[model samples]
Target chain A: MDPFRKAIKGYDHDRIPVWFMRQAGRYLPSYMKYRQRMGIEEMMSSPDVIVDVTHDPVDRIGVDAAIIFADITTPLSGMGLRVRFLDSVGPVVENNIEKSGISAVEEFDPSSFSHPVLKAISKYRERYADPLIGFAGGPVTLLSYIISDGVDRDLFRVKRMMITEEKAYQAVMTRLTDMIIEFARMQISAGVDAFQIFDSWAGYLSPGEYEHFVKPYVYDILQELSGSIPTIYFSTMTSSYVADMDLPADFYSIDWRIDMKRFSAEIPDEKGIQGNLDPAIVNYDYALHEASKIVEAASGRDRYIFNTGHGLLPSTDPEKLKRLVEYVHSVNL
Target chain B: MDPFRKAIKGYDHDRIPVWFMRQAGRYLPSYMKYRQRMGIEEMMSSPDVIVDVTHDPVDRIGVDAAIIFADITTPLSGMGLRVRFLDSVGPVVENNIEKSGISAVEEFDPSSFSHPVLKAISKYRERYADPLIGFAGGPVTLLSYIISDGVDRDLFRVKRMMITEEKAYQAVMTRLTDMIIEFARMQISAGVDAFQIFDSWAGYLSPGEYEHFVKPYVYDILQELSGSIPTIYFSTMTSSYVADMDLPADFYSIDWRIDMKRFSAEIPDEKGIQGNLDPAIVNYDYALHEASKIVEAASGRDRYIFNTGHGLLPSTDPEKLKRLVEYVHSVNL
Candidate 1:
């Protein structure tokens, strides 16, 4: 069995499964070489390019799993929104979905929307022996990007809709949840071994708001996907809500702000846990030593996956990341 | 006694003390009127202007305490860095302090540095009857802005230095703590009633990293100032570190992420707890109802001060804020 599968099953393996989020992107110099030649929209929408970049970090850093190369907004284009990846500023929607525009958001049909991602997943699965992980933005997170220009710290427009137009907000969230389910199912059918749901902006909500507005949809998505394959629920900057998050996925991915041991104690042993390492540590001089501290903290915990609390930063050193993987493998688990 | 003083003293009053972070900011039209005329640097440096802007929110919104209107980076100007508040981008240093430039960081003297802020505090105290709250940036947060151009989310350079150049990082932190102590003392001596230390970026550290790299200096600042008057140690996005913080302050101001009831249960009643309504909720359509939810959560808690978890946003409606204050004061505590 693959190391990722073994770790998820809670079997005693010689080494823990390890993967860094965003491992395939800008951090790798080779990936940047290709990125310079094409725009983000073109690079992500091409199956051949997606497969190449997806395989880059695994080839260079030797991580345990290979996540498919695709942006979360890949499906948004088919949903009647024009997504643009601007410089300095990140992914922005040229046309934002207001309450009046809610009727314009069509249900994302997997066959028509994001066919390139599915094709890339199918192609990459044939090439790589390691577990192929699939991912999509959580429903509310994707809604945040579509309704607002991009993921906002304040989430002003998102919350205003949630407050002022409750019916419309629910309709959009429900549709997005259905869309994510369809998207994840398509990736799973394409031979992806596991799935990760990235709820990056869920931290902006109050616990009450999260429970009322966000949790049910998240629970529904995990429930739909859990029986099919291992599902990882990753929410950044939402550590305070962990104890209250009753969703039972195979793995819960934590951010660096919370202690791994404390987080482990809160969840059941059968469930797996991945990440909480600060990605910024790689830009520093003591990357190796700092990575070792995370390793020590995670040791002896059942089903713990070695990964960063957040995505690997754009400026991450590939050599440092390679060293980190070597060190994680060398640890006596 | 002022309502703010009553709450801090753990005394029961007719109404709870109400204040919002960034109460005197761009949200007010009156502030923008002055800001349009003079630049941010010039406005902050002028005592007459600072006094007027600081009074705007108190007069318009009817809050209890008056936080002096000044940027946390106000003293960074005196420490050999030139500060500029750009139009779109917030505060930026014209010349950011780099690792190679660490030697240039100088200790701030109250008499020599930030004299304008002290002058503003003195002038405001004479005009206002409400307890004056003075504040300065915590060592790590100020260090982050100084080393990096602004408050970086990734905190790449800050983390790198903490790992690689440990001694230089320590030197900068030590001087910053001393400088903050000196800067805050000047405000207190100038007749401010209490002090708040804003460790806004400390949430980026792991518990161990926080305890190792950030906590000691924070503990020192609060420890030194706690005897003189109430000290509020406010750190944004760091509710998970509360148990491990071990840094004693008279009141621990938390962001809206944590449950207020749970937070109050964890801390002592005599030690006041301020804050934690999500500032974004103010922008919502049902601002009053949402603000009431926060009030309900904090209803029975002792020594609770009504305030937003973070600073009020620039687009936040002053009328909504005024109504929230009116509702908070109307509640039977």
Candidate 2:
């Protein structure tokens, strides 16, 4: 078994399995070359391009895993939402759920929209034995984009809908939860070794609001996917409430806001923990020194996978990431 | 004694003293007239305009306290940094600490620069029996703007400086801490009832990083101000590790990411707790209903202060905020 799989299974390994949230992204020169040739939507649709981009970091940096080269909004296009990737502004939904309503998502065919991503996963599986991690945006996070029609820093529109229009909010959340499950199932069938649900913006909600509005759908999705594959639930700025909630995932990927030793103590030992070196530290000359501290914190744990707290920045130097991977692997358990 | 000052002293009050961060800001129609007439710097410098803007919300909304109308970067001008307030982007420092070096801050005289604000505070104290709160940006938050030259979401540049150039980072941090202490002392001397240190962006650091890089300076400022006047420390997205650190403040104002009941329980009984209604919710028709929930959670605490988790949005209706204050005030312990 691969080191990542072994670690997730709670087995002691000789070397820590290290990968990054955005290993197959703009920071890599090989990936940037493709970005110059075509738009993100075009690159995502091309299985050949996806395979090349997914393999770039694994081959070049010797990372333990290859996350599928796709956006969290990749499945939204299939859900009847017109998704566009702008220059500075991230994924925008032209006809969002707030404008188009729940009726807009009624005709979504997950298999049809997810074909490109699924195809890429299958092709990558054929080419490499390394694990291919698949992901989808969480229900509330997806709704944040869909309700606002774009990237909103405050996500007030979504919260307002939840408060004043409870029934309508539940209807949309149910549809989104179903669509996400279908998308995850398709990726599983296509041979993804692991799945991560990115509830990136869920941290913006209060614990009470999260428990009331978002947790049920997250629970439903994680319950459905648990037996099929190892599941990882990822979020940022949520450590205050995470320990109290009983999330059923094989692993939890946390941001770097809390100490790893403290977070590890709070979480149960049965589950694995991935992540949390601050992405900003990678730019410094002493990047490896900080990386070693994160490694030291996870030293005694049988179930540990090394990764960054968040996605790599666009301006990151790829050589630094390559050095980090080698450094983690060299640390003996 | 005023309810706000009474509550801060951990005394029983007839009603919960209510205030909002950015209470005197863009949300009020009266303040907008001044904003239309002058730039932020001009408005802040004109003691008469500052007094009017600061009183607008207290008179109109009936909030318990009046925070002075001034920018967090108000004292930077004295430190020899050129500050500009762009339309959408926040305060920008033309000659940032990175470009101008520690020598740029050598000639700062806090009293000379804080004259307009002190005059406004003295003017407000003569006019009202209600508490007039004063504040300055915490050392790390001030350094973030000075180092980045503008608003940077990630604050990567500041983090990089701390990692690669520890000595320079310390030198700049020491200067900022001393400046904050001096600025805060000027506010207290001007007859302000209470002081708050807005460590707004300090939440970006990990607990370990915050302890190593930022906490000592914060400790110095809080220690210096604790006896002179009631000191409140405010930061967002820092709930995860706040309970562990021994911060010496009369009040800890937190953002809405965690539960009020939980946060209140974690904090010791001697210290006061303020804040944490989601500012976004105020735009909804049911805004007061949510505000009431916050009051209910803080019902038993003698030292509790009612406030929003963060600042008010510019788009917020002033009527809703007035109604919220009424609602919170009506709640009996």
Candidate 3:
């Protein structure tokens, strides 16, 4: 069995399986060379480009798993939203739900929309032995981009909708939730060995607000995806409430804000844990010293996977990441 | 004694002393009228404008305390850094520490630099019977601005500096720490009853990183101001590690990410907890219902101060804040 899959299943492995959140990204020089010629949309839609980019990290950096080379907004663009990847300014929705109404999203057919990425996944699976991971943006995080039309730091617009327009908020959430489930199911059919739900913006909400608006939809998605394949939920800045929420996912990929030892103790014993070295430290010369601290913290746990708390920064040194991966693979917990 | 002061001292009060961070600026109509005529620099520097803006919330919204009206970057400008407040971009430091070096900050005499705000504090003290709260930016947060040259959501530049340039980072932290101590002491002498240190960007760091870089500087500033006046330390997205830090501030003003009941239990008994309210909810029609929930959670704690988890948004309705204050003041606990 793949070590990453075995660890998530709570089985003992020879060594801890390791992968960074954004292994197949700009930090790799190979990906950058391709990016210079192709736009994000062009690169995402091409199965050949996707296969090459996704395999680069697994082949060169030696990560245990290969996450699909697709942006979280890829599905939104497929759903007929005018999503543009502006340089530096992330995914911008030209036709936001507020301007075009929830019907725009509700009308989306996930089966028809996600074919290119699914094709890419199928091609990758045909050639690669490593477990391939597929992912979609969590409902609230997707809604944040759709409502705000871009990257909003405060996420005030979405919070306002959640607070003021309850019915409309629910409608949007329901549609997005349904779309994500379909998207996940399609990816599973396309042969993804595992899945991750990236609720990157969920940390912006209070626990009470999250309970009221986000938890039920997330619960639904996780429930739907459970048992088919191992599932992981990832979010940053959510240390205060993540442990207590106890959503029914196989694993929780946490950020660096909280300690792994304390987080492991708080969550149920059956569930596995992934993550959380601060990605910034990977840029430092003493990167392994910091990575070793995370390794030691997770040593006593029943199930653990080593990974960064957040996505790799564009400025990260690939050599450092390679060395860190080598060091984690050498550990025999 | 002021209700806020009494509550901080762990004494029983008539009601939970309620105040909102950023209470004195933006939301109020009177402040907006003033903003139309004067730039933030003019408003912050003028004793009359400062006194009037500082008193608006206490007089109109009826908060228990009066936090002075001033931007966090006011002192950076005072230290001879070329800081400017662009309409929406926030504090832009043209002569950032990276460009100007640490001497620009090291050469700063807090006593000479902070006279305008100190003079404003004195002027407000003579006329206002309400306890006035003064504040300074926390060292790491100040360095984040000084290093990045503006509002950096990630604080990656500062983090990189901390990891790669250790001696430079420590020197900057040392000088900023000393400047804050002097600034707080000057505010104390100017007759302000209490103070807050806003480490607004401290949440960007992991626990271990925070412990190494931010905690000591915060401790030094809090230690210096401990006996002089009650001190409050405010940071957002820090629920995971704030409890364990055990910094020497009289109160910890937390954000909406954590529950007040849980937070109160985790920290020291002698210390006070202020906030945990989602400020975004204050804009809703059912604001009182949300406010009541916070009051209920805080009912059991000894040293509790009712405040929003973060600053009040510019869109917050002043009427809602007034009603929320009335509702909190009516509570017996």
- Check candidate 3 and list the clashing pairs: none
Question: TM-score for each prediction?
Answer: 0.95, 0.96, 0.97
- Rank order (by lDDT, best first): 2, 3, 1
Fraction of native A-B contacts kept, per candidate = 0.77, 0.80, 0.72
Clashes per candidate (backbone, < 3 Å): 3, 1, 0
Residue-level lDDT of model 2, residues B1-333, one tens digit each, is: 778888999877888999999988887889988889888888988889999999888889999999999999888888888889988888999888777776776556764675688899999888877889999998888888888667655668888878878998898888888888888888888899899999899888877788889999999999988888999999998987777667999889989888777777888878888998888888676567666677788768878898888899888888888888888888887
TM for candidate 2 is: 0.96
* Alpha-carbon runs more than 4 Å astray in model 3: A77-80, A107-111
RMSD to native, candidate 2: 1.8
lDDT by residue for model 2 (A176-198), tens: 89988989999998999899999
* DockQ leader: 3
Question: In candidate 2, which residue ranges exceed 4 Å CA deviation?
Answer: A285-289, B285-293
Candidates 1 and 2 compared: the better one by lDDT is 2
Per-model TM-score (chain A alone): 0.95, 0.96, 0.96
DockQ of each: 0.67, 0.71, 0.71
Q: Over the stretch B1-333, how does candidate 3's per-residue lDDT look in tens digits?
A: 878878877777777898899898788999999989988888877888899999989989999889888877777665677888887888898878777876766545854675577788999889888888899999898888888566766788888888888898898888888878887888898898889999988998888888887898999999988888988999987888898888989988899888666776788878878888888888676667766777787767787888998889888889988988888899986
Provide the TM-score of the second chain in candidate 2: 0.96
Residue B42's lDDT within candidate 2 is 87
Q: List the residue pairs that clash in candidate 1.
A: A276-A309, A277-A309, A284-B160
